[model samples]
Target: MSAMLRKWVLWLLGLYFVGGSGAALAALPIEHWTQPDGARVYLVRNDTLPMLDVRIEVDGGSRRDPAALAGLAAATAMMLGRGVGPHGGQPALDENALVEAWADLGAQWAATATLDRLSITLRTLTRPDLLERAVALAARQLAAPAFDAAVWARERDRLIAAWREAQTQPDTLARRRYAQAVYRGHPYGVEATPDTWSAIDPAAMRAFYRRHARACDARITLVGAIGREQAEVIATRLLAGWAAHGCEPLPAVPEVAPLERSQDVRLPFPGAAQAHILVGRPGIARRDPDYLPLLLANHIFGGGGFTSRLMREIREQRGLTYGVFSHFLAGRHAGAFTVALQTKPDQADLAVELVRESLRRFTVEGPTDEEIAAAKASLINGFALRLDSNRKVLDQVAAVAWSDLPLDELDTWTARLAAIDRETLLRAWRRVIDPERLVTVVVGGQP
Candidate 1:
């Protein structure tokens, strides 16, 4: 790649990692209901567009992965379109036929797994003919996926090769080492290796799907030109026969454990021109009480791009690296609070020291009143961008459902931020962050 293109890509990555947005639109009216089968639904009707987006959040993330088969949940989700079993009048359709079926309808369907949720989403026009068929096809995949052994073999080999290639990267190595130190003995730290992929067969994927993909435990979010009544029918259809009626709920998964002490690990990667450094520990969950205040505080800390303190100190002032950022990976379990950067191999120590010092000072003194005001203004003003499209709105609605937040969370977002002053932010920051216990991992030229 050319130097100019490399710089542009790095800039985009920096902006994405330093994440925050503003809101300038009117309040969104979110409608909520529960189906007879115990599935909860949230709807945001936007008749301005003819497109509909349906998202289903299931508790089939890596958290539910059997220790021996770390990638089963994800593998099952990835193979949803590989095939679907015969049901009602439709014959069994293989992977290619499934793809052609969706192509015929001019709609899209996909399932993806993350740390805490396995999401299945579809996009189709609001026309009755297309929408009805789209819902039926998605239901088939949900009710009875084929989990073909031949497909799994090919996918497993491809994934193993991809993972092995990624491990050779300095950034990937740094992230792995940091996760190990921060989330030791926690499912949140679980990563699928080549051996784990080898161990996960089609049977294991089927078992994982059956155990976790139940309608009773689902949060279905719909955003489109559809009313509550139409959405209800669509949601019920998509989740039809997801699980048997009288089955008992699965056992609750354990929460992520907090780090007992700080760890400093340096991984040797000779000839690495740019060193990667990560400092992190177990942070907050989605339902954290002080989530709003902490969100603003994180923006000022490192989440806000060039205007953030980390950028000003590490890159702008001393020029240690092109970028530095702090982010909270909040989810169902406590995700890590991470501050990361890349710099020259020789300057890794200085970069690490500066990041540590920034954390210490922020935890102690907190952000100033001016900083708080700036962060709120920046975030609130740009929040509307987050919901500019149907897909983005679906994402916000799905997150609200997954986190069990109030239906009016998006409407009252700016009001909540406006109410938070310096004292509230400072108190929340101090409670959430403790620099003394942060784990530091550096992957660079020297050990």
Candidate 2:
């Protein structure tokens, strides 16, 4: 094997053995500091590779968009990397020039919008000159997006087309309607329809960017072969010039009310060979005390792939569907627990009933001690793969910072997983999972 491939293999094997020991990996010594402009910064120094990864998460996403303009925050995030004219005396940089500059420095950058935050990520070689240049370019993009009129018009059209196309997909439609039914009048339920996209004017997007993407609400995480001093310098350069804004606090996410009864909705799709099934209800938030237990419980119930009860019962035993799985989303606020699967249209009803039964059984009896132990073993041992690289580590760091999770959570993850007993798992399941309250949406012909 080539040297690089051989090195990676050995590295993975080493992590696997570490996981097998049931020992938590030592946490990265995360250094926390605040930028002059009030951006929160978290850094971890790992000189194992000559690379740097930076992620900036602002407390603004779809949840913050005006109800009338559901896609505004998403559109704003999409426009951040496009181009920016001179602002506060800085020179202009068009989208192409900005991209070429990063290419010249052997770096890359991208942005994404989510339910709770908008994240902008950058990666580059850890050489001081390259890192500095990349950070400066990112800062400019974040601080002064041009929101060019022509570009906004084109992007608006593209977004509308994409939404229209998505409406034709059964799985997409099922998931969207499921969220709407579950959240019901909550901001989380608001989806971007064609009208939402069409209403997205450049002026509104620019205003939303300025209001929500300020340094005051930004959480920055950096992982690289750099020292504390260098990391601080990079962060300052990236955030110092942005003026802080006194934006209104984010609206509190209302508690998701339990379903009064099981609701089933079916939408017919012409010539659909399979039915898309979504079963779920409101779940816990990231900081919920039951989060860990729910996570462990989910693995045995459905999130563990073929090893899960749902998959075993529905697919392997009954042959109801090819795949079935469940997961808790754990967002900034109370999120969702979703079980998704697909089967022949004629078998849709049976599949739904089987899913409900699986959930009922799992919650009522919970997983056995052996099952819990096995689940914990699998989850703990597999986690090392998540921190196998600088980029992956950076992603974890960003998650912790943005979610306001404890700094040592990553270091203690395996130990925490190993510590959960069967009782704890059962208690979490009883408190969180409710099959009777699930809202089911199936898209296809009736069975």
Candidate 3:
């Protein structure tokens, strides 16, 4: 064989084995329903694993907190899992019981404050007995949390100390500052001020919960090791007692006038070696038409790890930062596109420049052919891993339902990715990201 022909054979074999033969992707078949109390539910039955993960999301999130009570939503969210039923044995007790009942029936709970909504999530094993107990606990948490003052004080103090500690960390400070600046007047932008947090008494939390935690404003997502029959039974039992709330309207979100702002926060850490920087602005929401396109584009831009543009330019080529990344965090109402990095205080400016320039170039020319193709391949090929576990599958299901996307959306993810070309991507890039409006915040930087 000729020398050139042998090299060609080797390359083809490598591509076939590495990129062709074993790449497989799976899509979840999503189903939807509306409960008698007006709550929406999305279910994906994947019996491959013996686990059930459920997430209950509401339309009122931190953005719903009044200016005088900024942290009210978060405080209310915490109260949901604490005390429920008589003897305060409703939620927290049943929750603990469910965990101990089934060793393999692990369960977890969490909540988040977002521009558009607040979500409470629970994961449990799908064993019939285990699932029933899990549902009962969730129902109690939803329908009858006591909001006891004693528990409230303890949790509040913990949160306050946590917030204080978070303030001391350079990265946390930078992120919070960026959110405040870019989101400005909007509920999406409000910071957890000490005043707002302190004023959040139990009465205020009770009011918030009474107003926001209702059947009319909720969504329940069920995924994994479950079918339609099982999902419906669980949904009905969990959501049945959530009385419709006649609560007050959400706090008005001020219209945030976009601006280019820059500032540096100096902490007392004299010997701290790294400066954490965050840049960007209030961006697209979940309903934006360009959401999917930009999602694909971002994976190539910076969300794709070592293969992303920011990592390639900032870390691989220049070695300015250990890791640099950018992403669009879309919520029900509003989202933010954030570019973040940490570097030696002295090299901070240089790292910021690299991020700025990369974004500038991305908006101007978009991703190259190679980058686009590779990103699509990576996203499509690796998409199945997202469903490898019931918990992960349920997470996506919750996001889809909360975002109000079509029930069959996941099935279309691959085709949608395949549909994009260079031109399509450049158009998407322009719509979602604008380098000129980027807001930069640096914390713990050099003199």
Q: What CA RMSD would you report for each candidate?
A: 7.3, 3.2, 7.4
Global CA lDDT computed for model 1:
0.85
Q: Which stretches of candidate 1 lie over 4 Å from their true place?
A: 1-26, 245-247
lDDT of 2 by residue, 1-447 (tens): 655446445544544544334553534578888876778899887666789888988878888888899988888889887887786677898888877887898899998889888988889987878877778777777777888888888888888888888878888889888998888877788898788888888899877877787777889898877888888787777775466545457666567666677778899988878899999988888889889999999999999999999988999999988888999988877787899999999899899889888888887888888888789878877987797888888888888998788888876777677778889888988887788898999998473
- Lowest-sum lDDT 10-residue window in model 3: 11-20
lDDT of 1 by residue, 221-330 (tens): 99888999899889888888675533458778777776778899998887788999999888899999888998999999999999999999999999989888889999
- Judge candidate 1 at residue 214 and give its lDDT: 82
lDDT, model 1, position 28: 72
Report how far residue 185 has shifted in candidate 3, in Å.
1.9
lDDT for model 2, on a 0 to 1 scale?
0.82
User: How many angstroms is residue 12 displaced in model 3 relative to the true structure, after the best TM-score fit?
Assistant: 26
Q: Evaluate model 3: give its lDDT.
A: 0.73
Clashing pairs in 3: 84-90, 116-333
**Estimated TM-score for each candidate:** 0.93, 0.93, 0.85
**Alpha-carbon runs more than 4 Å astray in model 2:** 1-25, 88-90, 244-248
